[model samples]
Target: METLHEIPALRARLADWRDNGLRIGLVPTMGNLHDGHLALVEAARARADRVVATVFVNPLQFGPHEDLDSYPRTLNDDARRLSRCGCHLLFAPSEAAMYPHGRDAHTVVEVPGLSAQLCGASRPGHFRGVTTVVAKLFNLVQPDLAVFGQKDYQQLMLIRRMAADLCMDIEILGLPTVREPDGLAMSSRNGYLTPAERARAPALFRTLQELAAWVAAGTPPAQAERDAAQALSVAGFEPDYLSVRRRADLAPAGPQDTALVVLAAAHLGRARLIDNLELDRIVAEAH
Candidate 1:
């Protein structure tokens, strides 16, 4: 229920909690709260004694042509929703607070290979912004655990890798992707969709599902990716990338790869939606 906007104040509160032996959890987000974001708060509440949810719309993660200025900011409503979801604190900082040195002069964090493909390929310097801001949050909150949604599978993977590579002691947990009844992955950007586009949006998830089925049934990975992209085109989406990659490092999937994920991102009307399914899990359930 308490909201702290400045880093020093938030860090002081977290320090007090740590001194009192309370376990802390962090759920980092850009505002425009929805069920999917609340799900992360709920997961944090279950795992830690106190939860801090951050609501700063990071400018670093957005490209020049992307909706940085128009990205939704519903802070008051987001605060009310997080409090109801049992969040203990909300750290909603201004852009200047996040980048005191200005974005151009700010230190950047890049996961190199991981940041060069899929969504990264399409949105240049996107993950650099993500990794840097997340690193800042991780440093500020210093939580025992942090929760992220699997709806952003690439983001989740890179954060985990960054924390490990940088020797951060915090645990990174990825909760399942929350979805609408029709299977469209719940996203803050979903608000950009018009009513007509919304109706056609579930096809993104359905396309990933079909791709998973194909990979599970022994279809060639490259062929399955091409066919899935084609199917999305027919479903009224301009496909970005529909890929099968090793779930571990997101390297392209080879014939013998068992642990794999089907990931897709595409343009639907004014919104870009992304979704993924783990093929290893699907293949296991076939027996």
Candidate 2:
């Protein structure tokens, strides 16, 4: 329930908890928390003795044309949600506090091959910003474990890689994606969907499901991707990329692979939505 805006004060609080042998869990967010975010909080609660959620809307991660100016910031509602979910501390720092004036040198973590595909292809330097800010928060919070939603699957992978590569002691957790009843993945960007577009948004997930079916049927990766792309167009989505890759390395799935992932991104009106599904289980069911 306690909200601390100052970094030193928050660090001191974490220090106090650690000094008393309490396990700390960190859930870093950009505010406007929803059930999906709370899912992360719940996961953290189950593992750690104390949980800290940082609600800073990081500017570094946003692009020039992105919705940084208009991204939702509902601290009161977010606090209430976190409180209901049993969060211990909320670090809601200002932009200046996060990125101080005269901040020059920056540390960038990139997961070489994975960062270059999917969302990274469209948004250059996006992951760098994300990694930088996240690294900063990790240092600031210094928790025993940190949790991120698997909705941003690539992001979760990159953070996991970065943390391991850098030898950070914190345990990185990837929680499953939380979605709306209509099958649309929950995101702050979902707020921008018009009523008409909102109705069509589930088409993205449906297309993903269809793609999963194709993969399950032992279809070729190229054929499945083409079918998924065509289905997405037919569903009224401005398809960005419909890709199939190994769940681990994110390299394209080959003919011999039993497990694969269908990752898709498209523009539903002005809002861009991303969704993915696993092909292994669906393929198993098909056989």
Candidate 3:
């Protein structure tokens, strides 16, 4: 597999693939790949003739206090794994390659209301950074399709919105969240957890599972959210936002809404774990 570190080379290669009549798929990521990330590559290969995976630990997506400097970079190992998973090319661009004009002057792409709530409320300018960088990638590769994990449900939702709003003729495919046998959603940030914190981590998923039960049992989402936050505190977590929202637009789900999702984000030691569960599955399980 070829590894590229510049924009011109990436576009040149993509153009060659396009000329050869090969459909391309993109899987953008911040290295430290695990099974979940590899699963995205597998999904990409299934749908496109050539798969290009990028590893840019986007400084734009991180805040001043966030772990930008400390975020793990395992490009060599990541490339090996991606190649093993049938990825055709790996684009590992440097911060300068991505920012080009420096972050302050870089053009920003923000998705209005969707970028402001939930995780956005916790990390201001976070989604703006996400949308901006992703927009750049979409323009650079211009792949026929791109794949993302549903673990970052809100980010997935925002990306889907931005792509459509901008009319980028690319198909956005979201694969289901891959989890550990213990049920923890796989995240590169999960590496930050200490052994004991890791043991306690699954509680976040368990909490969402319980919240799904509450919603299925006719309990109001707001009430379930309040109770779940309290539960997280008892499980040794600094709760962020835990709520049930309409899956269609991520607005708060009212009683009449049958399609809903329970999403949660909380601090567990150094690792901030986020997870979600669909209400439809919960209702199905109940019956």
Structural similarity to truth (TM-score) of each candidate: 0.97, 0.94, 0.97
What tens-digit string does per-residue lDDT give for candidate 3 at 1-287?
99999999998999999999999999999999999999999999999999999999888889999999999989899999998999999999988998879999999999999999999999999999999989999999999999999999999999999999999999999999999999999999999999999999999999999998988898878899999999999999999999999999999987778888999999998898999998763333334
Model 1 whole-model lDDT (C-alpha atoms) = 0.93
Query: So what's the TM-score on candidate 2?
Result: 0.94
Write one digit per residue (lDDT tens) for candidate 1, span 1-287: 99999988998998899999999999999999999999999999999999999999899999989999999989999999998889999999999999999999999989988998999999999999999999999999898999999989999999999999999999999999999999989999999999999999999998899999988898888999999999999999999999999998899997777999999999998799999999783333434
Positional deviation of 197 in candidate 2, in angstroms?
A: 1.1
Clashing residue pairs for model 2 = 216-283
* lDDT score for candidate 2 against the true structure: 0.87
Candidate 3: segments with Cα more than 4 A from true spot? 281-287
Positional deviation of residue 234's Cα in model 1 after best superposition, in angstroms: 0.9
